[model samples]
Target: MGLLIDGEWSTQWYDTKSTGGKFKRSAAAFRNWVTQDGSAGPSGEGGFEAESGRYHLYVSLACPWAHRTLIFRKLKDLTDHIDVTVVDAKMPDEHGWTIPEGADPVNNAETMWQVYVAAKSDYTGRVTVPVLWDKKRNTIVSNESAEIIRMFNSAFNDITGNTDDYYPEELHDEINEVNERVYHTVNNGVYKSGFATTQEAYDEAVTELFDSLEWLEDKLGKQKYLAGDQLTEADWRLFTTLVRFDPVYHGHFKCNIKRIADYPNISRLVHELVAVPNVKDTIDMDHIKTHYYWSHTSINPHRIVPKGPLIEF
Candidate 1:
């Protein structure tokens, strides 16, 4: 809920009033890409070669965006190759995302914003997590989770020797189609509903969210995953949101029309995804709950994090 203005850290919240109560998320500023051959990726400059132990990831387990990158890191067998440092569960007023005692690793900076400053002296914008840090270059490879996951999906294939392409050439159209709908109505929809300043915005966001969930439920009833039978990136993308729905979004975000458990297909699909080795390890409900409730003072002024609704998955 804070941003850097001319490299100075300032505690600030989104001004939803300017957009008539709609929470408009700003586009990510860092658009660098990690290509297989150190060539220029889809955006940014080249020379970002894919090498083992060259990159380190900074993530908040609570963040679904960050969660995706962690999932890819494990699925791609890049755990030993790339290192990760997680922020503490609670984000205090003074330190936005600090490393608790004995938790500091990587750069051991006082705050996550410090990492941004380290990368770019005059960096400005929201200091978000899921930062892909390049140890070799001593800079960030990318802060945008979407692109970072893509990098994890295929960038270090030679090192890991895992060529499982989630974004296959033949399925690009299908994956893009699914990603577009899920990103708008489900992935970001929960945020829209939770951060909505107007009744109309909340209603619209909630409606689309449930509609997408229903569609997903029906789709899962027929197919095993989002993109046909094979498990693709779309399913994992949706899994991060679904895993958090019942535990956090249902009550915390006011997305309680129905829990994922109510939709048997989604519930089962979620459990299956969680069953994947190391996938469940990536989830930390403590961090997930603390980050959303404590961080968003606008939504929960009391800042009281919930404890009930024990989820089996």
Candidate 2:
């Protein structure tokens, strides 16, 4: 809800006035990667080798992006290799993402903004979660969830000996294609719809969101997963959003045209994924609902968290 300005914390919400009521998500500030051999990653400097007890992950159970990294960690058997710290569910405007004093063992920081400041003294960006911190280097390896999950997919194969490939070599083209559409239309589209300040913006975002959902419904009806038979990174990325659809996005975000249950294909897909080992344990419905309803005071002024609409998943 807020960002750091020149290493100083400033409380501010998304400014949609300049974009004509559209929500434009900013790019992540930290982009370094943690490789197996300490080589440079796609975008940032290297020297972050994959080693046990060398890295710590920071996440929020409410956030979909942060949830992806957690799923990957559990699936890849890296739970023993990497540690995590979950921030408090409610993100206040005055203090952003707060944890109890000394809750973060690595940095001993009270707030998430302090973690970003610790990485770079003059950092300036949104204090987002799923931050991969390198303990030895004393800096963040990556804050981009997409890249962080990719690193988890392969970086620690030798250490953990779990080489289950989600992003396979043969399915890269198809997975990337599917991820491109889902990222813009479904993954981020719901956010665009909920945060829009104008009628035009809301209409455009919701229409695209449902269109993509219908497309997914048709695609999933035929195949077992997003990219052919194998479950890939694309499926996990979209899973986080679908799991949250009925619980929060449907009513709170005004994406109520059709719930995930209405689309049988999508519903089946969610159930199957939930049944996956270590996957269901990653979901926390109470945290998911509390963050969206209580944090966005503009959407719900009373901060009343809903109690009904029992979601099976």
Candidate 3:
């Protein structure tokens, strides 16, 4: 709902006017990766070694992007190795993500923007969550949820003694292919549909969203997971969005042409993922609903959080 301009917090809604009523998401400002041996993996500088007590994660339960990192943490058995600070679900317009005093034990800041300022005094951009902070360096290792989950997948394997590889080398091509489609169409498609200010933008986004959903349904019908028989990073990435479909994206985001329940394969995948140990515990429906309905005053002026549309998964 707000962003940081030169390290200063300013309350402003998404400017769809510039994009012809389309909601264009900004790229993550921090892109440093955490590797096992303090060496660079893909982007940014190195020296961020994966140590047991060297990193802290900041997340919001409501955010699907952040949810992906949480899922990876649970699946990769990095819960005990990496600590976390979850921001409040009610993101006030004045302050982006309310942390309150002492909520973030790592930074001890009241708002998320302050944490960004801590890393870089003149930082400018949207203050998003699932920030992987390196306590040893006292700077953010990575704010990109995709890269952060990758770090959790393998970086801390030696420390935790859990070598579950979600992004297997053999499945890289297939996983990337599925991720590209899901990221543009389904993962970010709901946001594009809900935040569109014009009919054209809404129609275009929703059309692609459902089309991809149908494609996913057909894909899952043949294979056990998105990539193949083994559950890979692609499945977890899409899991966050599919799990939130009925609860938040359906009515709240106006992605109601068809519910996830209507797609048997997709619905089965959602349930199967949630049934994974500790996976269901990562989800907080109240937080998810409150954040979307109460925060987006542009969508619902009254800020009345709906009580119905009971979801089973």
Maximum-lDDT candidate: 2
Q: lDDT per model, in order? A: 0.88, 0.93, 0.92
Give candidate 1's root-mean-square deviation (CA, Å). Answer: 1.3
Residue 142: error of model 2 in Å? 0.7
TM-score of each: 0.96, 0.99, 0.98
Once fitted onto the true fold, the runs of candidate 3 whose alpha carbons sit more than 4 angstroms away are none
* Ranked by lDDT, top first: 2, 3, 1
RMSD of each: 1.3, 0.7, 0.8
Q: Give candidate 1's TM-score.
A: 0.96
Query: Per-residue lDDT tens digits of candidate 2, residues 219-272?
Result: 998998999889999999999999999989999999999999899999998999
Tens-digit lDDT string for candidate 1 (89-191) = 7787655777665454667786889989999989989888889988878888898988998998898998899998989888888888999999999999999
lDDT score of residue 4 within candidate 1: 88
lDDT of 2 at 288: 93
Any idea what lDDT model 1 has?
A: 0.88
**Superposition TM-score, candidate 2 onto the true structure:** 0.99
